[model samples]
Target: MSTPKMFNHKTQLILVALATVLITVFTLHANGYLRHSSEQDALYISEFSLIASVPGAQGLVSTKPADFIARCDGGYLVMDAAEKVSKNLTGVLVDQKNRLISCR
Candidate 1:
């Protein structure tokens, strides 16, 4: 690295600005801004569990080896399955980015 005496005003300002932006991004990520919250994760898990319990229901999207999600848009598709004693869904929720959001 160059000596402090060799650093000019423009170079110092650029370095300071870059450092500030990096620190801001790090702080936000530390507060859970970079990933989904636990609540969203649980909602998706619950829905996947419900669908998996169905007799013949299948998952349309696999986010993990042990988890899958059934995406719902709308169509005249009729799926058959046993009468679940504790599972009912009226609609699918999506995020602003058009990805599978969750039912919470």
Candidate 2:
């Protein structure tokens, strides 16, 4: 003869509670509602200036915002408002006379 296995009531309640909490946490995280502070720090643009230029840049021949684009010496330039260009800028189209132009 074999005996049937059974879960104790307290154990069952604990398991249910744990599952509920886990599901709630998972749901919140999936929806971007719950995130660790460290995760927020990861939300960074590789190129601050390039990201800023997306909406402001019109076209290759089109003119850029005068305030955003500046003239350094020989050519035109695009500067980052956040002033985080050195490390963040991915690529440079032209670097003339300390001016930054073109970004990808």
Candidate 2 per-residue C-alpha lDDT over 1-100 given as tens digits, one digit per residue, 9 for 90 to 100: 8887688889999999999999999999999998677543444433323334577676454364422333343354433333434433322234335345
Per-residue lDDT, model 1, residue 103, is 31
What's the TM for model 1?
Answer: 0.34
Window of ten residues with lowest summed lDDT in model 2: 87-96
**What is the C-alpha lDDT profile of model 1 across 1-72, one tens digit per residue?**
865677789999999999999999999999988875555344432322234656777667666543222443
Runs in model 2 lying further than 4 Å from the true structure:
1-5, 39-86, 89-104
Residue 76, model 2: lDDT of 40
Error of 2 at 68 (Å): 19
lDDT score for candidate 2 against the true structure? 0.53
Q: Report how far off residue 13 is in candidate 2 (Å).
A: 0.5
RMSD of each: 12.3, 13.5
> Global lDDT for candidate 1?
0.52
Question: What is the lDDT, from 0 to 100, of the residue 12 in candidate 1?
Answer: 93
